[model samples]
Target: MGGLEEWKVLGGEGDQAFPCLEKLSIQWCGKLKSIQVLFPALKELTLSGMGGLEEWIVAGGEGDQVFPCLEKLSIERCGKLKSILICGLSSLVEFGIEKCDELRYLSGEFHGFTSLQLLRIQDCEKLESIPSVQHCTTLVELNIRSCRELITIHGDFRELRSSLKKLVIGNCRLGALPSGLQCCTSLEELWIVSWGELIHINDLQELSSLRRLSINGCDKLISIDWLGLRQLRYLVKLTIMWCRSLSYFPEEDCMGSLTQLRELDIGGFSKELEAFPAGLVNSFQHPNLSGSLESLWIYGWDKLKSIPHQLQHLTALKGGGATIASDLESIGNEIAKKCGGLPLLAKVLGGTLHGKQAQEWHLILNSRLWDTEDGNKALRVLRLSFDYLSSPTLKKCFAYCSIFPKDFRIEREELIQLWMAE
Candidate 1:
């Protein structure tokens, strides 16, 4: 349908056309201005690069249903589309619109979509507001980003609090977070990034169910309510980066209270902040942190000269600060070659050997796994690395990971809970 100027009615004047068509995609139809066809059985419809489309008119009549079974609809790069009027999409479960430059407002209420789970809108510079989701009880994920004119999200979150699991808001023009966000207690993952006007992050104490929280690229953010963070006791992974104006650090006593935190990542601070947070760096042996912290990653600290010496006390750390002897360079290279140029294996081996002695590195380089002819070199080396785990529980955890498919992004807290249940 590329370069098509118009799509005529399918079949005949009163015929039920394409009643069984399940999927249809129209791409680069630059001259198409309107689509009035009926797809009674369509489950997915995609329209992309529709350069001249100005309208999608719905056939209005008694008992007429268009796209009655559509579960997913995606529209992208339709630069001239000003409005979307087609209705009867109550079955839409996932709706995404991106790069529709001329779209300003969605026309109807989305609460009719009882089965809707994911809605994503991005890169629509003219879009000011989206339809309310106040009654969309089954909505599981909402992602809105790069809509420069969108100043606020409209709707209460009480209906979404029970089902919404992931929420991502980024690169928008809102000066503050939406007022209803505090009510989404069921949200498990939240990311706020690339926002320029937000100066403070307050009122998140009620998100007790949050497991992963990331705040990045908010240039003007100066402080977070640490009291609120202390209340999110279920949070396991936290990342804060590229927030050059943020100067506040949690108090020393606060780290000891976050008993469930496992991973912490902080970096890209301004140079005026000469050192890492004393609470995190100076007090690594805090009882809770020593027992719970498993991974710590810090980078882009241009002014800091060395890592904290006390970090060695964290026995649970799989990868944090490690000092390799200058003498181990050749042995390290040999071990790296045995990794078969696989970066994942290299990363795993490095994390496994973090804070180990020089003799340990040599022992790996000379292990019989390298001499075994029965398996791939990388697999043999990976097995050898797995055998080096000092804790039986840690080894069991690693073995349990084999149940997941390769490259699966397993959630850390969920894995911990599963291990506990085991």
Candidate 2:
């Protein structure tokens, strides 16, 4: 029900509305001010685009339960919502709030939710702090992003050390990472992005179970403790990009220990970076990393004159190669000439041409798509790659990814299911 600006209350005193309703969604009702109903069996509730809603009041005596079995609650774009007086939601497994620009505080009793597992808060411009979830022992995923005014996340990390697996915090104003973050020994995936005040990141050696780590767009980051990174023996993926001030690259000795690393992406250095780090080039030749690597992406090194010859030795790369056959060398050089040394375009073309037949390389070299301006070459290359995909389902899956927000991480099983649904 949308555009219901005259509604002030959903239920009166002593009223029991939808006693057996298991799911409810109220969207875009701008002036529907309050929800006073008792939904005893509600398992999911969504209030979205409620522009005039200021409060959600639980109507009952002090000890009476309103929604005893509610498992998921989502509130989005409720611009004026300020308070939610709710309790007895001990079974809530997921809670998400987004784009509530005027919300500064949550009046709900979140501490008693013992089964809570996922919590996400985003785009709440006025929210300064999150309520403490220290008592939620089962919480596994916490994601907070784009809350410009958010200052602190109130929680006791010691209590979440064992259960929390994934944590993403970005686009906020915190001067430093949350205290006690290193204590989450079970953390598997961590992303730190767009933070401006953080200068040094240390203490990551404590997260022994980490599998993927990404640090991007941190304009002020200067150095990372590579010695600590060497301790992550199980790390599979690592990405460091757009951190212009970061000058230190891990030594070859430090990279030797990452035996399980499958993907490495490091680029976007400052103009002051006169040359690519010698240590990184040598690290690529290390038997441990070279044999295990499957994907490699390196760009933004404008000063580098040539691609590393050591990259040719990474035999484990999936359908990727740097050297062409003797017959196709001239065609390969022609393709390179067309790319004009743009690092990003070169990387894309390399992926597309590698492991393809000789005729396919000629097709790409002779295509009219190359007649476009230099700036549009990347798009043409992407279009060519998309056309080459043999599986229609794979094409649909690739296109479906654009529906999500940038930097959003979706699990493999979930993404496959979404593709199937589509």
Candidate 3:
């Protein structure tokens, strides 16, 4: 049963043909054309990488049967499979399909699935659309990603919205957002990414219960309508990244109204900007806004020169006798400490002697020495550490680690095995 790679073994042909198997996996069996596996107690089944498999049918005692006790099923990377005909699976809850390019249809009828809860489809490039679920009332979560040919989603999504709390779609050519998604009052998180032609953000106005929202890599996006987001009073985190055409942040008092907003990350905006807005940093320090605001990351601003002076109040290091000017210097000093020593500050101090020494240690400990000009300086520090290891046994043990690939984690067991083999 373990290593019989190529032998046609029928289910009822043998006297005792694995009737107690609750889980079965058939992998890399190149000549397997058909499977009539009938395990009455089977709850989970997985078929993967079997190249010659063209069809599969599960039969009942004598006629068409239903897997009344099956809970999970997975089909992956089988190129010849064209469709999965569900005869009867009354207890199935979760189903997953991946990388099967030739699969064009999921099943003959969608109403057969009465208890399915989660359906995930990924990387099946030839799949055009999902089968409509007319009878699946208990379904909750649906995730579709990287199916390039899938352009449309049909059927009433609102029917599942009452129980479906999470929905994610990414890397598909979907051109418009589905309507009536706002009725899902129980939805907490929503995410959309890499839909090339998506230009509208107005469809997000209906999500009143959404606490977290993220949109990234949608190149054609132009603006965000803050008026539509007024109902999202409980929103905590908002992130918008890699939107090339986004020129402006919401007007000063726009995001200030979200009293519950805690974190904001607006990075990779490909436009040139001179500086942040005047009252922008001050808003983070406002009494109502200050209590919830914790982290802010703004990157990819090519023309950004410095942080605003008011940002000093937002740092945790500000305390008694520490004026704004002094606190600013303290923050800069902390960053310099983390960098070992500031190259800019070292140049102003007349030379980089101390800076060079600090940089060398930083490179050696972090193991980033050989990847840049600073690596040569890091190598000098690493050699110094090696010089102290004069013991032959310790030196040989450390030298053996060099055989591993760069950035590899050298486990204690692997080192012991290498030594034993030697």
Candidate 4:
């Protein structure tokens, strides 16, 4: 609709009436200023790239229950849009707005949607505030990202702590969490990010149901209470990244109580971090780490090597032509478990047992090599040297080469030709 300045109506009298229409998408109608159509049965509505649109009000006036059955509403790239009202949309379940920079406010009581479960508002730079979800008891996921001007997340959450499973707030300037977030005991996954005024997450202790916690890019954040964190027995994955002011991590005694903890990551360009946990806690030990801790561990931005740099591609060893690709993979899995992310150990182990049977490799993997000090020393001493060639044919080749003068250097190509001729 390049020249079309308005969209007045849709569907016709008979078969074109769209009586069963469940979804409608309006896009690239730049001249369109208003959506003067309504679909009572529409379950989803998407409007995008309509540069002139200022407001979308369903055909009936303000008091009518317009879109009473709408389930999802998505608005994108309509920068001039100022308002959207879903006042009585009782069946609306999900609402999303993206790249609508001119959106000043969402004009509706979010509490009106009894079934609203997800609200995602992203990249709306001029948007100032959102209606509270304190009264919406079914809200499960709330994500607000890059709304730099957004300052308040209304405090009505405590009155009804619904089963909110995920909450993500990023790149905003809110100084603190909404007042009653501490009472959200059913929250499971939480992510707080960006250069916000929120200095600490000490208020989130009430999230007893939390399993994953990620805090990143908070430039002002300084400390975390690990003693409080140690009590979260169900916490599994913790990621703290790019928080330039954080200077402390959990003490060893607190670390010991995290038996259910699995993954821990910490990295940022902070000058205060000299030696991790060393100055943070009096003394720290790896033995204090929980047994169920399966995946990564990190501390300080400068001390740790990147994953891609340290864990080499297994195919690199195929260049040595010692083991074929398929066989090397089985060997790789076993070696990774024993070496604990040491590339040298994996490479040496792979080359050392190149031609060995699968059973032999498994036997070596099950050994106490990683536990005993002498065993670790033995591994450091071991190498995939040429003398260990188990094949008698290769051994004879080495012995026969001694027939030549001691200082004479033999070319491998000539040796292959001689062996083929024999």
Candidate 5:
């Protein structure tokens, strides 16, 4: 805390004597720090929304390991935190850190986490590297995202080739896939997005056991080579999106090779891409592979906004229900026209006139406010929103008074003063 002012930290050393304390969460405790917490029996710990914490200084004990029973740790949105130490947390299995904007580094001896299975790091804008996890043989899943300043993944993961199954990397500066990944024959799922620095990934063909692959929004990537993806007979799903520079897909022969492929999603390629190769669609629809291709999503049409189709809305008024009066139907038609094919607008406006008296319905139909255009289109749809009111000023004040109880009396001066204050 630096003794700058008052601070609030949870759990004094006296709590260490409690053997049954299995879970502890310090949230929105702006001043909480390592020096103020000593929970020896805690099995899971979460720190969130801590605004003043600068670093997590590892705790020490007389001679034994601290946090000997701790297995799960999650830290999020501690905006001022810079670093943390997990060197002695040998029993930790799951670790997740996110949204600590000032964090620049993680300093710890990470090799001791023999039990660590899942690790996720996200939105730590200044985190520069992931400390070497080459020793985490039991690690199974890893996810890293939105760490734009994180240019390097320090782990080689040579020993984890057979253990790791899922990997995701997105919106980071990580330059290239590590050579160790070439030996990850057991890896099944992979997702990469918005990685601007990556230029080549031809080494991926080594993953003969791979099943799902997704690559998206990587502006720098230009091609997926045949040798890079052809041998994976087990591949079932593939998606490539927003890689504008890519002009080609694996050839028809290469696609025909994937007997198990079920879904294909490719989108956002630029106009330079050549027309579909001679037999690409034919091969996909071949009698031999008819049932294999279950879903195909191609979004190369850049000018297309959405699927063009008529939208229909079902409502009591739109159904020409028995509740309507003959005179107000014209006004309802006008409102529907103003809605301009949007179903939600028609419903809200239609519901406004439902169950109204004939006089009030006539007043709404004759209101002059709807004739004038508002400054904003989206806002215009709701303009003169309480169309039952007569004037612009009354439109603003009627909503406030609409909540009053039936026949409630109010002095004229107080009502005027309230409107002025508003």
Candidate 6:
């Protein structure tokens, strides 16, 4: 009935009891291993930093022993725990296990988890396959990240796909998406990142309900079938980055079917690309994009020379209602010379060059200083803004922005945290 705090256990002699406790957290109890019957009404339990604990139960002879009423459970960095006993917690809806290296198996059937909705497993290097979800129809979100040994999405994807709205698989060895993913009509957002062996994802076209899609660091991907994505009328954001084999964007009118597209990011082009696609800017003014397309980013085009005339059409759309933006900082001088110092290029470079040194500032505008001749004087004028950043802390914080990949918008809070962590 009352809040209990800072109770240290010297030895396992006393029979601790908290009948009214709904939340129990056990931390740093070096000698504690098996939890004796206590807190019968507990709804949430957290076990963290308990190094000496080995197993949840000592031996057999158990019938609904620990945490019978627990609905939420979390176990972090408990290296000695081999298996999590979920047989008794019928009321559990959310469960998380992280950094449990010794955990190799999750025993039991999904039929018992009638009330479960969210399950997360991360940094469990020993885990191989996820428990079959034949009966957990209530599950809405499943996140699996950094599970190096996990190789498959085992079991019937159709049964689990209908209820799952968000599925994220990152930093795993999954070579391909499960074939049953097409049955997931309710899926709204899907993200795949750093999957080394993933070569192609043709089944994504069937996910008509998808509203946001992102793919990054898929080095093996050589081509994308943009025609398959036109069916997603509700899709608002499409981002593709670090896909080295991708050399060109889709045809000029390829994305014309996505009427609701508000943002598009195609960055991390391989250094082999000599220039932007011929009709890239014209594609933005396609019938589908007339007044809808608002933001666009194209980065790492090493040999890009000038902005296409169609880009000027985007300026008209921006003047009318949309807000246009680009991350072509490297080609700012080329763009300035080609467009006769377009206001958009000047504005973007002004923000990117703010607080940078005279020489360093010149380098951003005149991308290849050793090869360019026209922008040396213009770059000198851009260095005047560097005097604004006088504080040591702020200077370090701004300099840290260099750590992020180009086109990345640094958040104010994240910048401060990175500064303080240093």
Highest lDDT among the candidates is held by which one?
2
For residues 1-422, write the lDDT of model 6, one tens digit per residue.
01322243355422255667897766656556655445567888877756665565413333234455778888877777777654535677888888888876776545567777888889988776676765777778888888887776666768766788888888877888765877888888888877777877776677888888888888877666666776778888888877777665665565667888887766665567666654455566676765677766555555556545555445324334332223434444554664345464466456655534346555655554334344653453344333445677766765798799864435678888888898
Q: What is the overall TM-score of model 3 with all chains considered together? A: 0.66
- Model 1's number of clashes is 0
Q: What is candidate 1's lDDT per residue for 212-307, written digit by digit as tens? A: 999988888888877787788888998888788877886564455678989887776665777767766644778777788888766554465566
**Which ranges of candidate 2 are over 4 A from the true structure?**
1-15, 56-64, 82-88, 107-109, 250-252, 302-307, 322-422
Candidate 5 structure quality by residue, lDDT tens digits, 1-422: 23323332545454455567888766676765544345677788887877888987655552126677889998998999999865756788899998999998888657678888899999999888888877888888889999998788876877888888888999988768755987888889888888878766677778888899888887777666555676777889887767766665555644556677776665665446545432344445444334465655554433323421211111111223212133454556666676567775576556666656467656655656356554343354455346544577977677667656653434467678888986
Model 3 alpha-carbon drift over 4 Å, by segment: 1-19, 54-64, 80-88, 101-109, 133-135, 248-252, 270-286, 302-422
The regions of model 1 sitting more than 4 angstroms off are 56-64, 85-88, 302-306, 320-422
lDDT of 2 at 189: 93
Error of 3 at 14 (Å): 10
Query: What is the per-residue lDDT of model 2 for residues 11-63, given as tens digits with 9 covering 90 to 100?
Result: 45423556679988787778777565667788988888888888766556431
Model 1 superposed RMSD (Cα): 10.5
* Residue-level lDDT tens digits of model 3 in 219-338: 877666656665677788887777776665554544656678777765555456566544456565666555666666554445556656655555432132111121222333443443
lDDT of each: 0.77, 0.77, 0.63, 0.68, 0.69, 0.66
Better of 1 and 2 by lDDT: 2
Q: How high is each candidate's TM-score?
A: 0.71, 0.74, 0.66, 0.66, 0.67, 0.66
Worst 10 residues of 2 by lDDT: 6-15
Predictions: Cα RMSD each = 10.5, 7.9, 10.9, 19.5, 14.8, 11.1
